[model samples]
Each structure stands twice: as structure tokens, then as C-alpha cells.
Target: MRKHFFGSAERLHLVLMLALTFSTGVVDAMGYLGLDRVFTGNMTGNVVLLGMAMAGGTSLPILRPALALAFFMLGAALAGRLLRRNGEGWSPQTSAALLAVSLGLWALTVFVLLAPVQADPTLGSTVTSALALLMGTQAATAKRLKVAEITTVVVTSTITGLASDSRLAGGKGTFWQRRALAIALIMLGALAGAAALHVHLALALALAAVIATAVTVTGHVAHRRAEAEAKTGAESPSLARD
Candidate 1:
């Protein structure tokens, strides 16, 4: 079936995206709980929270969400520019972009280490801005890559698709694995990150950085294997997935 593929490259890409999705949950928990009640991955939540704060329903600060929206827009714009220049499937340029986001998270980890001691120690606007910008870039890049259900950052539409397309609801059953995996990874990351944060604030971001870097390394390996196969007059399995 078209919905399923046997190519190793596409399967690797999907697995990498799931790792990044887990990182998204970790970073988002960091942002929402640690960084002034802002959401780094899910801009929809930021928008709604901003509106709620405006209407006096929630106590979240409006500035952080506003900054998240602005920074995410800028990040997405940058990712769009990069994608236009990339002009191919799963190019190195896209890997570079993903790496950049992870590097930003590592930078945030340093900031956390330097932070002053406090009882609650909710982070500041800078952490929120850094994470939001990268998440926006990540969301855009994932969308361009066209993974079936692995958006990596946001799960709202995935949830909607899951419910709206079920056989019980009289719609074709598709994306069951991708959608289920996406949801599960995010939840797992959130739980893991939340537990880790209680031990050390920077540990969550560090873990996220590790997962994101692993994705990049996996891409590099796949790309190298594809090149080798090409030179050997063999069909590149990785490129086939592309």
C-alpha cells in the first residue's frame, strides 16, 4: 500500500522524527512549567493562553506567549527560506536546521546552569524565546518533509485526524501507527522530562539535545550509505525512500 513503505531511508526518517517529537515534549514541558508558563512547541496553546490571559481567565503572563508567537514566526520564516534553498528530499540543509535547534537547546542548558538559585526558579523570557524559535523552525521543517503523522511538535491536528478518520466514525483507517506513536512519544517525553526536571532543571534540555543530535547523526549515516551505493552501481535504498 502507498501508506506503507519498505524503504530503509523513509523508515529511518520516521524514527528520527519520533525522537525529535520526544524532544519536543521535553522542551515544551521545560517551557510551559519552567519558562514563565509559555508553550514552545504548540503555538496554538500560546495563542489560546494569550487570549485567556487577556480575558482574565488564566494567570499566565501575556508577554512570554506574545514573544513565543513572534519568535516562532521568525523561526518558521527562516526555515522556509532554508527549505527553498535546499530543493531536495531530506537534504543536509534540513539536517543542519535540526542540529541548529538542538544546539540552541544546549545553549539553553548552559543558561539554566548559570541561573540564580530560587525556590520555584521559573525561567525568564530568554529561555522561552530561544526554545520557541527553534520549535517553530522544527514544525515548519517537519511539515515540508511530509511525514504522514509525525509533525514532531504539534499533536492537535494529529488528534483531530485520528478521530475524524477512524473506521468506527465511517472514515478510512490510515495513519494509525504514526499517529499513535507521535502521541505516545510526546506523552513519554513529557513524563520523562517532568520527572528529570525535579532532579535538575538542565537535565531535560540536555536529554532533548542528545535525542536531536542522534537524529542528525542517523541522517548523516543514511546519506553516506546512499552515496556509497550510488558509486557501486546499486540502487540506493535510502534515496529510494526519498
Candidate 2:
């Protein structure tokens, strides 16, 4: 059990999960601050916000929220295709590819922000939609991977699990602890990103790109090790005979 818990693969997965959480926080903060309260990283929140907007209680534009939802679904579909093709072997390669695409989009966003020419609302909306789609793709990939206590993009369910499994509720699980840690990390990332955004939005995004790149490298290494081991085992005669 100790070996399983502290294994290199497990550690790599944990690091990648945390990196995804941080990415979500940074992107979500950008969306909220720059895109009129629409959460690009958390589609669940966007769905709720969309419903509220449809009810006419909020000032959010219905079309933008709807576009966000559609784009998110499209991203999820793309991730699903990757998962289906790769199976459990998807590993870091899938994440690396997705992050690479996301990095490109973020670079474009930075260019737009730095450009002397200002964009109209339509252009801004398009940017937000693309960012949201990238985030959604990530969220779906994580979901398909099904890493415990590390969904990374949204924590509402994690928070609920924490509370439901707390000591006061006669539970002995560490759900609350894990959930709290995730929330804390996200808050820290958002705070750091927000501070950076004040002076340099591109800088904050660049930080996210760095984190994603690190995760991608680590994941690929781990997956390669696993594949090597699997191949070695397959070639063992006794194992094959059995």
C-alpha cells in the first residue's frame, strides 16, 4: 500500500492534476474579470450562469453564454475522441497535445491584448469562446482519466464530498482534507494570476503555459516508463507461458 501510494507514476499524476487545477484557476479568473462573469474553466458554473441569464435576472448576454456552452461541448467531444482512440494509454501525450493547442490560443489572446488596435465585442467574445473551449477540452480529458480527488477544473462536487464525509457526519475519510487542499491551491493560483493580470495579463498566461508544459513533460516521462515496463513484461517467457 505504501509503495502504491508513493509510486513514481502516482506522484507524476498528482503533480499533473495540481498543474491542471492551477491552469483552471488562472483561466477562470481571466474569464470572470475580462469576459463578464463567464467562467471559462468551469462549465458547470457557466451552465448555471446561463440558466440565470435566461431567466432574465442577470445582465449577462444570453448569446455569449450559449456560445460558451456550445464551444465547451465541442471541446469535450474532441477530448472524448482522443480518449476513445488512446484508451488508458492516453497518459501525458494527450495532455501535452491539448496544452500545446491551448498555449497557442493563449498566445493569440496575449497578442490581441497587446495590439494597439482595440477589438469590438464580437472579437472579444470569440476570444473568450476559444479559451473556454480549450479549458473544456482539458476538463473532459481529466474526467476521462478519472484521477481520484483531482478533477481540477471544478470543485463544487469535491466540496460536497468533503462536507458529506466530514468527521461531524460520522465519516473517517480524508475527503474534506483533499477538497480543502484543492480549493486552497486554486485560490492561491487565482490570487497570483489576478495580481499578475493587473500589471501584465500576458505574464499570468505565460505562467500557466509554463505549468502546462512542465506537466506535459512529466506525464510523457511517466507514460514512457510504463510502456517500457509493459513491453518488458510481455517479452518475458514465463509470463507468456502462464
Candidate 3:
């Protein structure tokens, strides 16, 4: 049981997913509290908000969520294209690239947050929208990659999976622990991010960028090693014959 939980590829996938989940929680919390309650990671909430805004029923405008959804789709589409071009083997590389992009965007957001620009409502809205879109894009890309547990943008599906597969529901325990762990990590990250925000918003963004960069580096390393092994095996006479 211990080996199955810790020595499996699923475990590694869960670790990576946990990292992304933490990042998502941090970013989403920042966006919601600091950016006027707009969710950056969860596009579903953003879509609903967009509709409400379209009907002129809320202070939140529709354009921001609309742009976020568009960017998210674009990011997912990009991931799909990469998958088609490189196959499942490219999942790590593609995910790393998307995370790298997300890190850069988050860094830019931090810079903007520290800038001397006045806090105008319109500008705030636009900037918030852009950041939210970046988050959505990151989330969508993760989803497209089908990484085991790292769908870093939202928890609705995770919650659904947990409840639907609970022992009380007469379901097997497969992946249930992983799902619960992911949710917990995300919540913890959100709390940490909120604390950082209380001290400094720029600091929170910086922290998020750091996490993303770390994931990018690790994913790249793992991908290269896997690719090298694949190449080595392909060239070996034994493997070739098989």
C-alpha cells in the first residue's frame, strides 16, 4: 500500500498537481479579494459573473470575465495543438511552458501593482481582467494537459469527485485521498496568500511567480530525462526488435 501510494507515477502527478493547486488558490484569492471579487482561476464563476454583468445587474463588468474566458480557451487550444504536435509525451513540456508564461504574466502584474499609476476604477477593472485572463489561461492549459490532479484553476470538479467517490457512497478509494489532499493544499495556499496580501500584494504575486518558476524547472528536468530514456530505448537493438 505504501509503495502503491508513493512509488507510482500517479503519486508524482499528484505532487505536481498539488503545487499547481496551491498556486491557483493563492492567485484566485488574490484576484477575488484584491481585484474586486473577480475569480482568476475558476472560469465557470467568471462566466456566470459575465452573464450577470451583461444584464447590467452587478457592479462587476462583463468584459473582464469575457476576456478571461476567451484567453482561457486560447490557452487550452494552444495546449491541444501542442499535444497534437508532440503527443502525450509532450505533456510535461507543454505544461512547463504554460506555467512559465503564467509566471511572466504574474511578474508583470506585480510590477504594475507597484507602479505609481492612480487607482482609477476603469484602469483597475482592465488590469484585473487581464490578470484574471492569465490565470484562466493557465488553468485551461493544465486541464488540456490532463495532468492527474493539478487542475489549478478550480475545485468544483475535485469536490464533486471527492463526494461522489466517498466510502459512504459505496465507491472505491481510488484517487480519493489524492483529491482531498489537493483541495487541502489549495486552501492552505489561499490562506498563505491572503496573509501575504495583508502585508503586501506585490509580495503575494512574487511568491506565486516563484512557485510557477520552480514547477517549470522541475517539469523541464523530468521531461528531458524521460525523453533521453525514450531515445536510448528506441536506439537499443533489444528495444528496437521488440
Q: For all candidates, what are the clash counts?
A: 0, 0, 0
Best first by lDDT, ranked = 1, 2, 3
Evaluation by lDDT, superior candidate among 1 and 3: 1
Each model's lDDT: 0.80, 0.71, 0.67
TM-score of each prediction: 0.88, 0.84, 0.81
- Which of 2 and 3 is the better model by TM-score? 2
- For model 2, how does the per-residue alpha-carbon lDDT over 50-150 read when each residue is reduced to its tens digit? 78877886586676667778888888788787677665534654766566555765575576567532246776677668776777777777776667787
Tens-digit lDDT string for candidate 1 (1-242): 11223366677778888888998899888777766678888888899999989998756689889998999999999998888766545787788788888788788888777884224334577778878898888888877777788889888888888888988889886987788889999989988888877987688889988887787777766776676666765556666878
**Candidate 2 regions off by >4 Å?**
1-6, 89-97, 116-119, 233-242
Better of 1 and 2 by TM-score: 1
Q: Give model 2's TM-score versus the native structure.
A: 0.84
Q: Scored by Cα lDDT, where does model 2 land?
A: 0.71
- How close to the true structure is residue 163 of candidate 1, measured as C-alpha lDDT? 85
| Model 3 Cα shift for residue 195 (angstroms) | 1.4
